[model samples]
Target: MDIFVVDDERIIAETLAIILRNHGYSAETFFSAEHALASIGKSPRLLLTDFRMGRMSGIDLAMEAHSRIDCSVILFSSDLQECDREWQMLQKRDSRCTLLRKPLHPARLLQQVRLSLSTEPRLGLHVS
Candidate 1:
């Protein structure tokens, strides 16, 4: 599956990309939403974005991306207290999207990714 990761934090983006790549997935990293959106037509299977980017928020990125192409979006944030708000907002717009608290357990992240991808009908992640 092809995954696009967007984050102002390069380390986080690269680390997630490495993890996804190790799982035999094609991953792309973008430091900005604008840069990533430029290639939105490529149709990534999933999107992983940081919630608190300085210029453009992840929610905005997801919205823009989803408008261009159908995909599953997982929004991550260090502020766990904001999770409920994030979840509610995303669910209102796209239920297939998920909000994950940052400093996430790698195992849990992978598991959620597996489950989300498998269950999402339009993205075609083919988790098996």
Candidate 2:
């Protein structure tokens, strides 16, 4: 698969996955970080997830996924300002990940996905 779209909100995850699929990319939806992690037998190229979720934070999942597989991560939050601590930890620990502040613009999301699929990974907090 090309990507795994995870969010605590099932509808959001499903919708994102569908959008990516409609754009000719392979994608899957997971309602929680744990479920995404559990299903990563053969990790997809990218993991797009929500920053806050039950039981596990997105950073924790990203770290764990990076440890187990070679995939990039994109974490989204309604307010990036409130997630400074988590964001800092993630930035210090990894460069193949990005934080996208919510109300994501579909075009920007697709652009980032394309850029992420390139030979190199990009690291900048994208607020689209």
Full-model lDDT, candidate 1: 0.77
Candidate 1 has its poorest 10 consecutive residues by lDDT at 119-128
Candidate 2: pairs in clash: none
After TM-score superposition, the amount by which residue 19's alpha carbon in candidate 1 deviates from its true location, in angstroms, is: 0.6
In Å, residue 125's CA in model 2 sits off its true spot by 3.0
Candidate 2's residue-wise lDDT over 22-88, tens digit each?
9999998998899999998867999999999999888889989988999888888898888878788
- What's model 2's TM-score? 0.94
Local distance difference test values of all predictions, in order:
0.77, 0.86
After aligning candidate 1 to the native by TM-score, how far in Å is the CA of 100 from where it should be? Answer: 0.8
Q: Provide the TM-score for each candidate, comma-separated.
A: 0.86, 0.94
| Model 2 poorest ten-residue lDDT run | 119-128
lDDT by residue for model 1 over 1-128, one digit each (tens)? 48898899899999999988888888899998888888888899788888788787888888888888878888888784655565566667776677777776778778767766674363322111
